[model samples]
Target: TQGDSGIQRKGIILGKELARSLGAYTGDLLAMMSPSVRMTPLGIIPKIKMVEVVGIFESKMYEYDSNLAFISLSSAQSLFGMKNRVSGIEIKVDDIDAAGHIAVVIQKKLGAPYFARGWMQMNKNLFSALKLEKITMFIILILIILVAAFNIISTLFMVVMDKAKDIAILKSMGATRASIMKIFSMQGLIIGVCGTALGCLAGFTIVPNLNKIVGFIEQLFDIEAFPSDVYYLDELPSQIQYFDSFLIIVFSILICFLASLYPAWRASRLDPVEGLRYE
Candidate 1:
C-alpha cells in the first residue's frame, strides 16, 4: 500500500506556484526550520532540515495554490527527530460516494493507532455552508423567474379576452373545456420555457465570469471593482451544475403551468351565450 501517493513531507503537499515563490523546484534542496519557543539560560533554538522537493503540483484552489510547500517523508521524519513514526496517512478512495463505507472498512482493518478521513470530514463546515448559500441564492433569484412566469399568465389572460368570441364558438361547437385549457396552458408553457432558457443562459454563462464582467462594467461606468474586500474570494465563484439548470427549467415549467391553470379554468367555464352577447 506504500506507493508514490504515501510519500509526503511535513504531512503536506507542495503546489507549483508556492514552490516557485519559495525559490525551490522538484528534486532541489530546501529547508524547513521550526523555531523553538522557550525562555532558557541558553536562549532559543531552532529545528531545521535539508529536504528535497519531490514534486510540484498546481491545484486551482487559491488556498492550496498559495500555501502548499513540500518536503520528503524521510526528511520530515529526520527533521522532527522521530524514527519509525508518522503523524498520519492520507488516503484517496476509489469512490468518493462510498467514502464512509470505505473509511469504516479501513478503520476496522487498521484498528487502533490508525484512522481514515474523507474530504467531507476535512471541509464539512465549508461545504455545508456553500450548499446552504447556493440554495438560498437560488430561492431568492427564483422570484425573478416567478415574476417572468407571471407575464405568461397575463399574456394568456389577454389572449382569452381578445378571442372570447372564438372561445364561445368553439364551446358551442363542443370543444371540451379541457381542450380550451390546453391551448392557454400551452401558450403559458412556451413563454415560461423561453424566459427560463434566457435566464439560465444568463446565469450560467455570465455569472461564472462575474468578476471579469464586473471589471468590464467598472471600466464602462468609471468605477472601482465593487469593493472586492467584501467577498471572501477576490472574484465571484460560481459553479453552475447541470442538475441545477435542470431543476430551474422544471420549476419554471411548473410555475407556468400553475399560473395558467386558474385563468384557463375561468376561460373554459365562461357561458357561451353570455360571452357572445357581450360582443
Candidate 2:
C-alpha cells in the first residue's frame, strides 16, 4: 500500500535493504529467477519472471532485511513450476521455548519427505556463539570481583592490626573473643555488601541504555562501532537475565564472607598480654 497502489497478481514486496541494494523502488520491475529449469531452443535455462515491486518491509535483522522478499503464494508456485505445491509454510508459536518440540510434532505428522525445523535449529550457531560470549563475560566479571575480594581481605587484616590495642582493652573489660571476631568479620562483610549493591545499581541502570550511550559516542566521534552489514544487525540489542545477576551477586557476597574469615580468626586469637605489652 505504501509503494504501489495494490499488489498485482504477479507483484512482489522487497525487503527495504534489498530494494536499496538493487536500486529498485515502487512500481519498478524486477526479474526473479528460480533454480527450476526448462528446455529451451539452445539448452536448459533457469526460469525467470519480471514482477512489479509493490511494497517494502524491514525485519531489523540485516540478514533478513537485505535478502528477504515477499510475493503472492500463487506467484511463487508458478515461478518454481511447483503447481499446487509449496516449498514451506511458516508457523508462529506463542511460546518460543516450545518451538523445537512443536517442530518434532509437525515432522512426525507430516511423515516421509516432509520435515519441520524450528527457528532455534535454523539459527543454532548464532545462539551458541552468544552463549559462549555470555560465559566469557561472566568469567571476566568473576575475576574482577575476586580481585576486589582480595583487596577487602587485605584491608580487614590491616584493621585487625590497627585495632590490636583496642582488642586488648576490650578483653580486659571482659569482652568475649567471639565478639571481637564478629566485629572484624562484620566490617569486611559490610564493605563487600555495599560494593556489590552499588555495582548492581550502576549495571542495571546503564546496561539497558548501552545502545543509546554507544550511539552517542559514535556520533560524537564520527565512528561506527557496529557496522550493520558486518554484524548482520540494524542496531545492537541487549537483554538482562535476572537469574544470572542474582547468581553473580550471591557469589560475590560469598567471596567476601570467605575473605573475612582469616582476619576474624586472627583477631580472636590475639593474646591480650602481648597486645598490652607491645603498647
Candidate 3:
C-alpha cells in the first residue's frame, strides 16, 4: 500500500516481502542485475546497476507481494537494453467478459507489431475451471429443487387421501373436476412461491456476509479456506445474478405445478358413492 514517491532513474519500488527478505527500505541502495550478459574486458558478465529503493508495497497476494517490483519505464528500458521501447502494455476495460472481442478489435485496428491480449486470454484456464464449478453447482441446485418438488407431490397426495370424503361431497354438490384441480394446483403454487421466496430472502441476507461467515467457520475449525499460497484470493467473493434467480423461481414453480396435477386428477376421478361409503 506504500506509494507517494515517484519511481525515477535507477529508483525501484519493491514488494513488501521482497523488501523484508533483503532487509531493504526506502532510500536504501541495492544492486539490480540484468539477465542479459555483456562482453566485459575481463569476461562475459551480467549488466548490473545500483538502484535506490523508492517504496515498498503490500498487495496481500502471495505471488505479487513476493515477486513483483515497479520501476520507471526509462530505467527499466535502460536496464533491460531496450533503449527506449517497452515489450508490452496493459490496458483495462469495463466489461471483462467482452475482453477477447475487444482484443480482436484492437488487433484489427492497430495492425503490424501492435497486438492486444485480454485478461480472459491471460487467465483462460482459471475461468474455465470456474465455469465448470458453476455448472456443477447449478446441477446440484436442480437436484435439490427436484427433491423439493417430490416432497410437494407426496404432501398433496396425503392431503388428497385425507380429504377424499370432502372431495366426494363436493363432487356430489356439482363442483366441476377442473375446479377441484385448480384448488389443489393453486395450493401447490402457493407452497412453491412461499418456499422460493423464503429461499431467495435467505440467500440475499447471507450472500453479502458470506466472507464473514467463511471467516468465522475458518476460525472455529482452525482451517484455511483461502491460503495465500494456494488460492489467488484472500477471501470468498459472491455475485447474485438476477436472471439466474428468476429462472430458478420459474423452474421451481413449474415443477410444483406439475407435481400437483396427478393428485388433483386422482381426487377428481374418485367415485362419490364409494368415497362416502369408505369414509
lDDT of 1 at 180: 90
Candidate topping lDDT: 2
RMSD of each: 5.8, 2.2, 2.7
Per-residue alpha-carbon lDDT of candidate 3 for residues 1-279, written as tens digits (9 for 90 to 100)? 665467877789998877888999888999999998899799999999899888888887767887999988988888899997889988888988898999999999999888888888887898899999999999999999999989998999999889989999999999999999888988888998899889999999999999999999999999998886678557776888999989998998898888888888887887889879966
- Residue 154 displacement in candidate 3 (angstroms): 1.6
lDDT of 1 by residue, 1-279 (tens): 111344455343466557667876555666668543445688876776565666666655656755766556676667777677988877777888888788888889999877887777778889899899978998887897778767777887898888899999999999999999888877777777777778778887787788789888889999866453333344566676788678778987889888988778878987799779967
TM-score, prediction 2: 0.91
Q: Considering TM-score, which of the candidate structures 1 and 2 is the better prediction for this target?
A: 2
Candidate 2 has an lDDT of 0.89
lDDT by candidate, in order shown: 0.74, 0.89, 0.87
Best-fitting candidate, scored by TM-score: 2
Give per-model TM-scores. 0.68, 0.91, 0.86
**Model 2, position 238: C-alpha lDDT score:** 81
How many collisions per candidate? Answer: 0, 0, 1
Per-residue CA lDDT of candidate 2, range 1-279, in tens? 257645579899887888999999888899999999999899999999999999988787789888888888889989989899987889999999999999999999999898899999999999999999988998899899889989988998898888899998999899898998898888888988999999999999988998999999999999999998999886788888899889989999889988998899999989899889967
